[model samples]
Target: MTAPALPRHRSAALAESLVLVGRSVRLSRRDVETLVMAIALPLLMMALFVYVFGGAIETGGAYLTYVVPGIVLLCVGFGAAATAPAVADDMGRGMVDRLRSMPVAAAALVTGHVVASVARNALATGVVVAAAIAMGFRPDAEPLEWAAALGLLLLYVLALSALAAGLGALASSVQSASALTFFMLFLPYLSSAFVPTGTMPAVLRAVAEHQPITPVIETVRGLLTGAPIGSAGWAAVLWCVGLLVVSSGFAAWAYRRRTRR
Candidate 1:
């Protein structure tokens, strides 16, 4: 059988996605628990790590500088994972069905989720960074370095949000989607986020060093500290680009399958 013809009006789809994105952003702002997790929790964790654990870790009196970049990624990762429950709730409540019945592009729903996720992540990152600064984390990076770091974060958020959207679409319930995202919450722990992966045991170290989160963490640290990033920076770029392409395709496929007439 011939495949269904795709939505042809790109302009209309873009407009619809923007409207939906705005709606999602408003809803998120009103979600007190989400606000706590996205903005407050990361800040709390940063404070706890820097104050509670800083003395133990040997970072040459720059522990805050060392850990702030990881905290930024932690904030963004948690925010990206938040998209799964939002998408699953919309699906469970028949919002997807209602949207599919309309004349809008089906992909617009996913795009809206991604755009909202990026906005939320950006806000959360800012909050975490501000908190870090207040807690005595200072970086001497120039404007261009900050721009590059933010750009990397945007790409990271987009990729993970798309993946979370796909996971949400595949889930049978909001609970399941939320459960699946807990892994994302735990991923940073296994990376070079807290301490260097070299300090990990052999097996854990190998896994931590090879995972996607490590290179991204390293890149952020390099950009913030003005240290040489070497191949880790390129690896981060590759991971973001690769994940974006893969996750976007997966999300689109899951959406189509979930909403198929």
Candidate 2:
């Protein structure tokens, strides 16, 4: 009887999560300004780097090609950060309290925000890729390479979205939740995103080289440009997997604490 009940419980949890995911996506659609900014800021940054700063930078090739991967990651970061406010709003407005009284699974709330974030990032990424191509950024990746790059990016987005949700659960207000995620938006600038790390000062270079963002950016850039990825690919996989595990656990713990009576 217990074994039979477990599967039924799991199925109910999944159905609850799917319903919450739809709710989150609808909320995102109504927030047109945030969605537009999430998609637009990356395009504006890509253009700035390619047209203005691209002429001044020496990347040993087209700056546009070297910079698109970074811009793509930046777009993902922006899209994921929006999850924090959504989660926080739910927490602050007593929605979590209302849901707690229902038969819904507690984890379903965070899962909804996470799934909605991934969908938003996917759309923003597609728009950024189209814009990059229009701005003369070309990639030499075959289909498999493209697949690998996108898969890794999806992992990174999942990790960051979970992290944002955790931060949101701990925040006292929606504004604080947004502030907590600002680091995600700024992290790529310290990586090999816009320029080579070797060009930086020695300390900054070390920080850029050792951080998780650098390896992820390097792996994507290599896969897209047909350059040697070396060990960056392996490092990227490990980093994304590690972050996902840690962030998912953190989100679960935070949500439980926040919703406890």
Candidate 3:
């Protein structure tokens, strides 16, 4: 007898997962609101902070300009948090096991979520940028430089998404996944988000300046303002790459642990 065909390890290639994204979401009209809830809320928070505290706080420039990038990162953070819950739910519902047994690509399980999140994040970023522009936040850099900044931010988001995937894979329940994801949103505020590190306490400032977020914020601000990238610019990229590689490995391992008999 002829040998039976074996299934592919991953449900789909990374590219194919793009189409699968958002498919499981918004199957009905009411569910479409998640787009706004996930993406628009951050921009709304940006507006709230800028208008409420702009005069009181001094960022050495337009408050909106200084704060918007941080807000974008925060959005990414909150967006990633959603991943864990969704993944946990799928597994709890036995959906993940079913998919794994099928001919689907293994990577598709995570890529589908990541690609969908990118779409939501892209929309969110657009809204925030438009609001900033309307409020007189101008980009001093050339279009290409602006693109570079956005590209870096997107990569950072991708890394965070992978990290969240690992968390989801490891979590035994949905409650823990939801609870654990809060750190990403909380950390940026502790950085140079609303205020410059120079204005913070001496010890806090030291830590903030050297942290991963400071480099990212500094790089994005420099690009947007046509300022210098400095060492932080390169560091930001390196940290993102480091996080992606490490977390991706863990996520893969966690998935196998959860799936393999």
Candidate 4:
């Protein structure tokens, strides 16, 4: 033999993942309504928070500055949640069966959706940041801080997308997949993404502070606004890494179980 077959198969799997990622991205582009809503909903929420609710909220500074990071996470939530339906559609329509009959690797299927989710979230985030800036959401972050924030966001999106893909695999129908992924969109509301966690009641505040989203939001906020990150950055990293590992494993397992011959 020329070399180990395992390495060759690994290379083939990577190639398949890249090709499927392109397919997923193209599918997303064709679905203009979903893409538009993913961006527009976040912008509308940002505007509502900045103009409608900004006056009432007290974050010790401009509300726009305080809330933009939260909105960024919310945008991520919307973008990542879309992966569930896409994967679900593929499964329900027998696309997965067709792919499975080919040389396609099961991991590549979920990887494609997760990568596409990250790409969509990146585009939506850029739009949200631009709109927020136009609406007076100024950030004092240096380039390094901005890089850190983006890196953390990438991790969070990867984790959520993997989780969404797993949920999609486990769902019996596309409608059920949509319902399963709803928690991704609702989770930010319970985080410090909007108002300060201190404003909530004791139990709600405890939940908000302890949840995965809160530390991620806090880390992003601190990076952008020059606030002290302290331990939140580390916590965010740990949370993202943990979620990514667990969700990825779950996605792989769920895909196998759903597609077993």
Candidate 5:
């Protein structure tokens, strides 16, 4: 008797990825802490910085205008870090092992998480922007400039999310994943997020000028304030693309390596 061949799982990878994205989104929505982190925390930080420190921090213009863009970028970075624990949780609970045993595509697992993280970050960005507008933070950007700023933010978030996923896959446990990924949370402090890097000490200024976050923040700030962006816009693009390529490659390698064990 001739046996019929089984259907290939590759044919359904996109569908499987979508299903997993929905699952991840559902899980995020159900968690109160996730909600707070994605929405409430950014809003709170925006208010605190713009209201409390806005007066003290003199940027030669409206401090609210100077800081709102940085706040948005900070929210995106936090959103990216949020994925590490989620990925680690799946690995810890052996959910990934069971998925590997199924006919699902190998890439779908990470893709689903990535897609969900993007959606989550978008919402978080909206929340932060809306709160900023309510608090009198106005950017002098044209509609086209606003769109460009958003595109830059999306690229940055995608790259950071991939990097965080790589960290998660490399970690042996959720605790380690959380700790390992803490760098992203503090990275903005070293750059131009809260203040101008020019005011930093010479050594600090050198680092802030050279690091990835500074260019990104500078690009966004320039776009919003109608300042000439110079080479920062291109630098931000290169940094985001380069980081995405490296981190995504590392994430795939780490996922395969972890699954083989």
Candidate 6:
């Protein structure tokens, strides 16, 4: 009970949590249909945006180039939100409670879901990027720049999935997670996902131009195209960090509360 022992115990808990996350990832691999469904929707978005909808949208840059980054960002949100319903499903099924009762690490429970979500995000990103390239969008950035853009895309997902997993855990059901995810997906779609901020309604355009997703999308576009990677890029990073911190903290608190009860 001594305060001096608290830090050591917490460290041990963290280690256990990480291991559980790994196990969660392994178990998720067996969930084939869920895996496929997660990848499919985002891929469909990529196809629809690039082919079916590309002509109608007029981005300032070449359509594919501009669209690629936005889709990438959108998928990160998609992947994160998509996982929420799964978590909710598990809770309703009492799988989560069963895990809580086991010796498995609590953090691992979150970690596994996050891994699956990220894996799905990567697949989504890959499909979209491949389709974009096929449609004539070429990334002209230096090797390092390309890597940076890819890293940012994944980083955003990493943060988002962590937050989403927490929400999913606390959610009363998977349906609730779906509603929450809709808001997450809606933010970027209403923002700079397909078209320029200038083209939106003046009020919406103002918000779209300044919202968290816009900066990240714009940053990726610039990086991929070797255009100026501006302040918006940094703003995008800050947004990811901020959201991650807030959602992750809340999820942790919620999980503790749930477990304690």
Model 5 TM-score relative to the real fold: 0.93
Candidate 2, 53-124: lDDT as tens digits: 989999898899999999999999999999998899999886888888888888999999999999999999
lDDT accuracy of residue 129 in candidate 3: 80
Pairs that collide in candidate 6 are 20-108, 21-108
lDDT over C-alpha atoms for residue 76 of model 4: 97
- Mind giving the per-residue lDDT tens digits that candidate 3 earns over 1-261? 977576444533654565556563432124466566777778778878889977789776778778877877777777766777666666677778777776667777777766566666676678778877887888787889888898898888888878887788778888987777888878888898778888788899888887788789888988887556799889999988898889788878878887777
Candidate 1: lDDT of 77? 88
Q: Better model by lDDT, 4 or 6?
A: 4
**Candidate 4 structure quality by residue, lDDT tens digits, 160-212:** 99999999988998889989999899999999999998879999999999999
Full-model lDDT for every candidate: 0.88, 0.93, 0.76, 0.91, 0.85, 0.76
Candidate 1 TM-score, C-alpha based: 0.94
Q: Model 5's lDDT to the true fold?
A: 0.85
Q: What is the lDDT of residue 217 in candidate 6?
A: 85
Tell me the TM-score of model 6: 0.87
lDDT for each residue of candidate 6 in 50-83, tens digit (9 for 90 to 100): 7798878876566777777877777778777877
lDDT of 1 by residue, 126-240 (tens): 8788878888878888999999998988999999999999999888898999898887889999998888777789999999988999999999999999756889999999999
What TM-score does each of the candidates earn?
0.94, 0.96, 0.88, 0.96, 0.93, 0.87
Q: How much is 86 displaced in model 2, in angstroms?
A: 0.9
Quote the lDDT for 218 in model 1. 93
Better of 2 and 4 by lDDT: 2
Q: List the residue pairs that clash in candidate 4.
A: none
Please give the distance, in angstroms, between residue 117's alpha carbon in candidate 5 and its true position after superposition: 0.9
lDDT of 4 at 256: 87
